[model samples]
Target: IVDRIDDNKDGYLTTEELKNWIKRVQKRYIYENVAKVWKDYDLNKDDKIAWEEYKQATYGYYLEEFQDATDQHSFKKMLPRDERRFKTADLDGDLAATREEFTAFLHPEEFEHMKNIVVLETLEDIDKNEDGFVDQDEYIADMFANEEGGPEPDWVITEREQFADFRDINKDGKMDKEEIQQWILPQDYDHALAEARHLVYESDVDKDQKLTKEEVLDNWNMFVGSQATNYGEDLTRNHDE
Candidate 1:
């Protein structure tokens, strides 16, 4: 792992190298997950998963058992949501998805082209009133639940201010689709880079900005983390058995 991450052959891992490695690991995980799901959903073996195939394979039981139900938590509700996402992912509007499209369907946040879908989905989730916009109350409710009616925490207050100042970009008292996109998918922040920097900061015991193999291996769990471990578990699992 260290050898692969040490891009310059300088026996040290720079922040950029670590960040790139993390990004690669995340993409690999997404690809492997897409492959597994595709194998399950692509019943016709035609290298494409049609909407009906996925819907039947996933929600057929609900369709058969609760066809008339339309509760908030019902599979009936989920069907429409999933269909909307599926249609968004189907770039050609063919009601089907290739592996690349399936990847976008599963992980819309990872693709630039799928950002609109991501924003739409987020709006759908948080905009319970369905007014085509997310108001401040809905935005705060999405992250916090003050069920006890107790005093608000400092963070909650900060988040309210954040919503008013940063999230409501147009001062419209609500977030439209564009504002929602900017809030959820901020262009300035790189999550992988931030995480890599944090890991290096925690593990770099020698006060150096870069990481040696020894430093990284000593904090192995911090570097490999749960996501990578889960991916390894998937890789080692024998489905044929």
Candidate 2:
């Protein structure tokens, strides 16, 4: 990873280079997922997946008679949701999805054009009253349970203040679609840059605001989770008998 991201070839990983590497990794995951799932749905192998093709591929099992009524009910609910998302992602309105459109459909949060859909979906999930807006109580309830009938935690109080002071930008008691979008997908936030900076901050023992290959390797666990090291699989398989 260090060798791939060290763009300057000065044996150091700068913040920008690391951020680019992380962004590349994210894109790679998206592309790989799309590739793995495309062949299953694109039965004709013409490089485009039609709406009928997708519906049959995904919901054929539900169409079978062996499924229970509860399963049928779930399929009925999910079918329209999937249709809406598929149509939104089909930019050409041809009712078919190319590789790019399929990517957008599968991971709408990764694309700027799909952000409104993301915001709308979030509101639909959180706005219990269906009033087309999210009030303070709804926002708090989404994050905290308080099932014990006890006083709110300090962090919950801080979040409520955050919602009033920052999230509800127009000082409205409730958050409209625009405010919900801003709250969830702030334009100023760069996830890759933030993660890169955090890794450097935690791993750069020399305090030079950059990282050497040795530093990254020394803090490998901090850079990546157990997936990279096989630590999780090993722990599960090698537990005391």
Candidate 3:
């Protein structure tokens, strides 16, 4: 029996070691079957399973045993790595992303940060335009976007919940910049605002100095510091393996 305790005695099942008990009968499977079920499997991009997102993606597999899930690799390939792909995912074309748009666009890791922004925060604060999903450019303009994510991006039940408590300022189910700044810089709210605004304002070549979609997104990389961006680095063509 696999015997590494999932918990260090928290009485709840967490901190469990997954790889130890993972029985692999893995192999490459049919592409069509997998593509039809694209959202089913493929939780984090490392291309493995047994996480919350994995379960959600492959809901039909809940009843099916993992050993029998698939005998081969069925995934078509990573997301298309192109400006168009980003645009399609962004939808609003703002550059920075709100929770909804971010989740849909990011590789597994980035979504963790996306979810954190809206965890329990008042929807009124960050949901500025009331479009359900805030535009990314506006997100950058506000610096509501920050360097926050989970150790394991693919897992829905992650450390992100801890950070969630920060966003819900009014306890009304949304995050306002004012509340977020509290967690971000402690007693330095004005400092945080000034620095973030500088990114857009200072970078503008025109005297207008307002954030352009591209200019705002240009610095998104600096905020989220992860290196596991393997969205087909070598396989640029996006073909089935």
Candidate 4:
């Protein structure tokens, strides 16, 4: 992600480059959501949704069936967020959201609250014993659930190692809140900042606050490896054309 955004090829991402990279990532995030939102809410296949359509589609039978406290709380919170988003997206106050307006409403980097929800969902799926945490066994089992009979894949092994070395702080053989926080945001530890800071920190070798191609090459493993960096796969999968 950083390399592709380094437009001058100076091996470092300036503030402007980082901003551009963030914009691209945000756009991708919004793009992915566009189809999903439309599919679920555009009941008439009109490619546009009014507030009532969105409300009905989102809160209809499917969601109402899961009326647990968590689900209820999530639904409650969603309304306000969506309302704000709708107002932002409804550029002409047309009381309807077009695809373009809906896209405009989504701010990807500002979705840290959603990240917590995702983490909770993942914990729910992986915590087989319902113990409120995931042990190494549970983590590995969930990650490699699709594998048939072969030895674990290299990526899975690397993830296991990371689970122990990085995520298992205090060596309790399980993850805790602090560890998960570190896992999510390791650097300045601020989830709101652009993720490009992490890439810059890894490759900036000279203490001059900038990087060279050689510096990036030297840290290739850190940039490419799954366990080492959060943005690696995103960079690889969404590289600029």
The candidate maximizing TM-score is 2
Name the regions of candidate 1 deviating beyond 4 angstroms: 67-73, 226-241
Model 2, poorest ten-residue lDDT window? 226-235
Best by lDDT: 2
Candidate 2 Cα outliers beyond 4 Å, as residue runs:
63-70, 226-241
Writing each residue's lDDT as its tens digit, candidate 1 over 15-81 gives 8987887787788778988887787899999999999999999988767776464642578777888
lDDT of 4: 0.65
TM-score of 3: 0.18
Report the C-alpha lDDT of model 4 over 144-177, residue by residue, as the tens digit.
8855777878998899998998788889998755
lDDT of each: 0.83, 0.85, 0.36, 0.65
Q: All candidates' TM-scores?
A: 0.86, 0.88, 0.18, 0.48
Name the Cα RMSD for model 4: 9.4
What is residue 141's positional error in candidate 4, in angstroms? 33
Deviation in Å, model 3, residue 192 alpha carbon: 30
Backbone Cα, N, C clashes tallied per candidate: 0, 0, 20, 0
What is the total number of backbone clashes in candidate 2? 0
lDDT of 3 by residue, 1-241 (tens): 1122122432221111212111110111223334444444444543432234443553434334345434322322111222233344454666433334434443321233333333323233445677553233333335434447433243332324434555454664444565554554355343323443444344444535343434434644532221111212312334332
Which pairs clash (backbone N, Cα, C closer than 3 Å) in model 1?
A: none
Ranking by lDDT: 2, 1, 4, 3
